[model samples]
Target: TPLHLNKVRDPDDQLVLLPHGLLRHHCCYPGCPEFLRDLRTENDLDAADAGKAGDVSESTRRNGLWQHLSPKTWYYARRSDAFLVPRVHRIARGVMDEAQTLHHFVDLTMRKLEEELRGRPAYAEIQEPWLKECVTALYGEYLGIMGV
Candidate 1:
């Protein structure tokens, strides 16, 4: 069976058949292994090209485009899960398993921060380079601790 490029759906149920090599570029993202597997399995070059009936040159090029440019298909053929799982896990680690308490804490903290920043007398006037840098660093540290 020939795998039609436009018919494949990704794990999230989004259609994966992007023209002009977009699929090849974005398949390396954190949660695309299932999509990559489906693409490779359905679009194998030799198998697809063997079934084509007309001009071998054009058929070969069109059929092989995904295979040629896909890093997941070429470089990590046997290790698709290995490539995607760790990154997915890292992202999931920051997400609260249960949302109630985390959401409440976040809401309260944000309100407090907003109040403190807005209450400052020099808040509008403190636009100096050092002050900006200090604010940026403080925000970064807060986010790091919050795992966001």
Candidate 2:
């Protein structure tokens, strides 16, 4: 805790301190869990707008409450978590969420480019006439598309 996070040697190892999280003093700092109040549902009600008019029951709840069950309660919870985890991860990574596996084609394309280029290409300070012409043309086209 004595050393600052910015002093970390690895660039990628440093936390992505984007806003929302950056607005906070620390990420995931403990505070009161906000959820409270009550929820009430019953298996009896087919749907609220189903228009099956018989007398249904009223409801009441204290500190924390949940209805007994709904027909698709398990399915709802499953789908909810299916969305929530990835969202949390995406926010944590500053919107650069990655999947478990990179597609073979993308990997192959990148690898082929790497092999063809030998190492990172140095477009900056390009001395060769052909290479400088290519870079200038590419930039000219980019500026044209950008309407500059």
Residue pairs in clash, model 1: none
Residue by residue across 44-133, what tens digits does model 2's lDDT show? 123322434533331111111123222333332233121111122223222112312223323332333334444333222123344323
Considering summed lDDT, which 10 consecutive residues are worst modelled in model 2? 57-66
Best by lDDT: 1
User: C-alpha displacement of 33 in model 1, angstroms?
Assistant: 54
Compute the lDDT of residue 111 as modeled in candidate 2. 36
After aligning candidate 1 to the native by TM-score, how far in Å is the CA of 26 from where it should be? 47
Tell me the lDDT of model 1 at 68. Answer: 39
The whole-model C-alpha lDDT of candidate 2 against the native structure comes to 0.28
Cα lDDT listed for each candidate: 0.36, 0.28
Worst 10 residues of 1 by lDDT: 82-91
